[model samples]
Target: MLAFRIVILAAFAVAAIAFPRAAIAAEESCPGLVARRGLPIVPASLAADAVQLTYIGHSTFLFETPSGVRIATDYNDFVRPRTTPDVVTMNRAHSTHYSDNPEPGIKRILRGWDPAGGPARHDVQFGDVRIRNVVTNIRQWGGETTLRDGNSIFVFEAADLCIAHLGHLHHTLTPEHLKQLGRIDVLLVPVDGSYTLDLDGMMEVIASINPRIAIPMHFFGLSTLDRFLARAEGQGFTVERRPTPTLTLSRTSLPPTPRVLALPGR
Candidate 1:
């Protein structure tokens, strides 16, 4: 009886190890982007499938998925949302975009910069949401020198929607960057003009991405935001200004044409 029990225990251990390895292999073979075929069409009554976005001030925006996963972009000490986020993505372009000391409650803290000066790589999966990044360069503060792979464009995929947050992007994206970004349904852009990319450069970036909805962030005040809105309008984008800073969006609920949404800061 003792010999039979030992054999069964060994079999269970081997099965446990082999199952995880097979799952990992399967996940590795899958493509990075979600395919757009055979997906169920979300109905008007099923607004619960939408993802919620809330502006937290500056570049910080809180994203809540349908499965209750919360993510905060450009997380910093100042302008933090009232509720704790399950995951936080930070950029080190300036103090306003990142925090050295993050709240202990956060499950995952994804930094856009590598301490070793290499590119920051992240492809994390939490519940129904998947987060990844495409590295980009930025100009050093008060200098003409450029830092390679200094910042990241974080991509969040949930509920059949692909959302991208451009963190302190300084220049136009290259072909490789575009290839890596794949299809972005929604975009969170920085319209600070001087601090990030200039108005013209940013406009070009937006054109290249061509997201279904563009939400402006990282701007100082209304003036900068208005300038971006005006330029985007010239490019045939409809502008919708919201009284509140929160919006719930889904794939089926997306506008027939691309539009710019202005959400007031809370």
Candidate 2:
């Protein structure tokens, strides 16, 4: 009992010491920015830019281009009036990832289909953006015995920036997965640390990808975000909590080194 108590106490001490340093490390990576909380309201001029994105609750996101090309990701439930999108992508995770078709005028729909035989790779082009999806392993129905090819990691290339989304990932990324991912400028990752990989595992993958911007998603509650930020503190990534759920981003406006942008998913 004494030995066990000592081990537990030691673990807590390590975590407490590690968190502050991690936070400081995140601050040092970026020279000009400061860490601030709460959402920022986006201006109309920025909203009208060429590449604009808005978080629409949970995994649902609305991305629009100046040419009116709108794309939605994992959008199938509790979405707002702005739910209309030119294209929608649904991964094979759960019912939340898919739903009945849109009202009308919705142009394209993409699903991450992984069959026993194999999965199909999609090279999608919309306006000036290009996207590709690669399949990986994710447990189905939360069972260890029953394994299926359902989840996928999608890569989007726009404005000379490559962004990857780890969809319902259940396992650590292999070296082959790294090779398949090539170079990513921004990464939209899940940090729930329960349904998705834990904080440490998420760090491993982020380290491997080494993207310029890391946007965390699929996490609930404020403390989940805090813990994720804590885990990434000393990893040399600046953490910015944007003031709003929306952001106007382009290749030119992106930072040179890695950073974390916490977007509001509601």
Candidate 3:
């Protein structure tokens, strides 16, 4: 009986180790490729010399320029005025981080969309904008103590400026993540303090990215906003709270030093 129990335990341990690696490998496979198979590739729908962005609410953003290139990040449900974006990227960390169904007519959808066994990786170009997604640690709903599908950090580049959005990021980025990040001009970051990393860790991330412009999102209210601004200011970052929700930007508009812009979400 004792010998049988030992063999059973050994088998169970090996199975556990083998299963996670297999799951991770499986989850890391591409979903869009599976969905589309091998169809002819169509070019993105965007124009040259146009770049603009707006903070809708939470992690939702509307980016379009005079030339009409639109993109959104973490566009979950409950968007006011029901603003639809040309491209929507979602990370399934929680309900707030994703929408059950995005508004109709969305041209492309990228969900970190990994199946239940692994991480996600993809490079996408929408219009003139180029986007790259890298999978980070997978976390539970509300990120409260469990891990599921690994979250994704997206880098968006257009009109000579690069923007990165860290979606529901629950831990500090690894060196591999930094290598994937490359250079970031503008960073749309979450400052909720608890759900994401705390203020100090966030400060460290900002220092690492060293973006010319830093925009805070996912924070609760004025106080949380204030804490973030205070930290940025101490780091010698100029804080600008744009009265207008939408702002047009270009490579020329990007500054040399780090600046934090707080846009009002409605």
Judging by TM-score against the true structure, name the best candidate. Answer: 1
Sort the predicted structures by lDDT, highest score first: 1, 3, 2
Off by over 4 Å in 3: 1-50, 80-82, 142-149
Residue 108 in candidate 2, Cα distance off native in Å: 1.0
TM-score of each: 0.83, 0.76, 0.77
* Candidate scoring better on lDDT of 2 and 3: 3
Give candidate 2's total backbone clashes: 6
lDDT of 3 by residue, 1-266 (tens): 00010000101111111101111222222222221123323333322433567788888777763335567888787653245677888888777777777778888888865865677766876545667787777556543565644688887766656678888877776665666676666788999888788888887777766666788998888898899998877767778776766666665656555678888887
* Each candidate structure's count of clashing pairs: 0, 6, 3
Model 1 residue pairs with clashes: none
lDDT of 1 by residue, 106-179 (tens): 99999998988799999987766789999999999999899999999999987778899999999998766776
Residue range 1-266, candidate 2, lDDT tens digits: 00010000101112211112121222222221111112232332323323566767667767655455667877575564365677877776677766665547678777766454567477777665566786777666766653455777877655455667887777777666766676666688889898767778888888876776788888888899888987776665667787677766665666655678887766
Which 10 residues in a row give candidate 1 its minimum summed lDDT? 1-10
